[model samples]
Target: MATRAVWRYRAIFAMLCAAIVFFALLPFGAGEGGVPGPDLIVCLMAAWILRRPDYVPVWLLLIVLILADVLLMRPLGLWTLILILMSEYLRRRVDHTEALPFWSEAGLVAACITAAYLVDHLALVLLLAETPPVLGQGLHALATIVFYPATAVFSQVIGVRRLAPGELDSLGTRA
Candidate 1:
């Protein structure tokens, strides 16, 4: 029963990510003079991973992020690589961070995102690839950070939550 719940929530996370990517590809106003939206993918990933680390395993993230990269026309592997690393970083710290207040979680999310953005920018520059404008990327990161709380709330509403004490022990080890 517990394993079933894990798989079920994993499937839910996957489908939500697909919906976010699909909306992103709509092209209603692609590249027009408006603010770039928050990276909802990151928000969802961070929220779900922090709350329930087992549910957003790296393999699932790797596949979904790769698909998003292909569909969104981003430079192959750049964003995917960084986000996977960030996800691992967050996942590794779940035990240490489970009790942190919301702002701290937000701060960690912001910090991870900030680090990912900086590394992404530095890498693109080194590769001589066209990078998005700094101001725009900064705004995008800020928007992502701003939207994280809502994403966390959404995850909670959908029943993706911290593993209960019994559930954790049932897994036979820490996540």
Candidate 2:
């Protein structure tokens, strides 16, 4: 039974990763004056990280973000590292504040998104790369923050529900 549960976790993670890759490949006009692609993928990833950290392992997250970097033509590993750090932070917070109200969770997501954009912008500056306008970055982060609640709802609807305490203990021991 434990083995089956692990497989189920792996399968779901794989499906999410594939979805991110597919989104990356879509012709979303990600260039100048084009649609700044929605950060739906990150929102989804964050939702899973918060709801079921074990289901979304760090290595798998790294792979997805790396693929996103390559496909989206961004600087390799910049967003990947930033997102992994953000997700891990959220995962730790989940342990303490799982009972917090939805508004609190949204507030945390907003802060994380803001931090991610700031770090990304800093990296671009340090590397002497041309950074987009501040307004654009702000809008992108705002969109990501706005979409997080919907993504969390979608994840719950799709059966990525949090493991019960007993189940978490069992999975932890097995893993």
Off by over 4 Å in 2: 28-35, 165-170, 173-175
Residue runs of model 1 more than 4 Å from their true location after superposition = 166-171
Q: Best lDDT goes to which candidate?
A: 1
Local accuracy by lDDT, each model: 0.88, 0.78
Q: Tell me how many clashing residue pairs each candidate has.
A: 0, 0
- TM-score per prediction, in order, is 0.94, 0.86
How would you encode candidate 1's per-residue C-alpha lDDT over 45-122 as one tens digit per residue?
A: 999988888788789999999999999999999999999999999988888777788899889999999999999999
Please provide, for model 2 over 135-167, each residue's C-alpha lDDT reduced to its tens digit, 9 standing for 90 to 100.
788888887888889888988998777666555
In candidate 1, the residue pairs with backbone N, CA or C atoms under 3 Å apart (3 or more residues apart, or in different chains) clash, namely: none
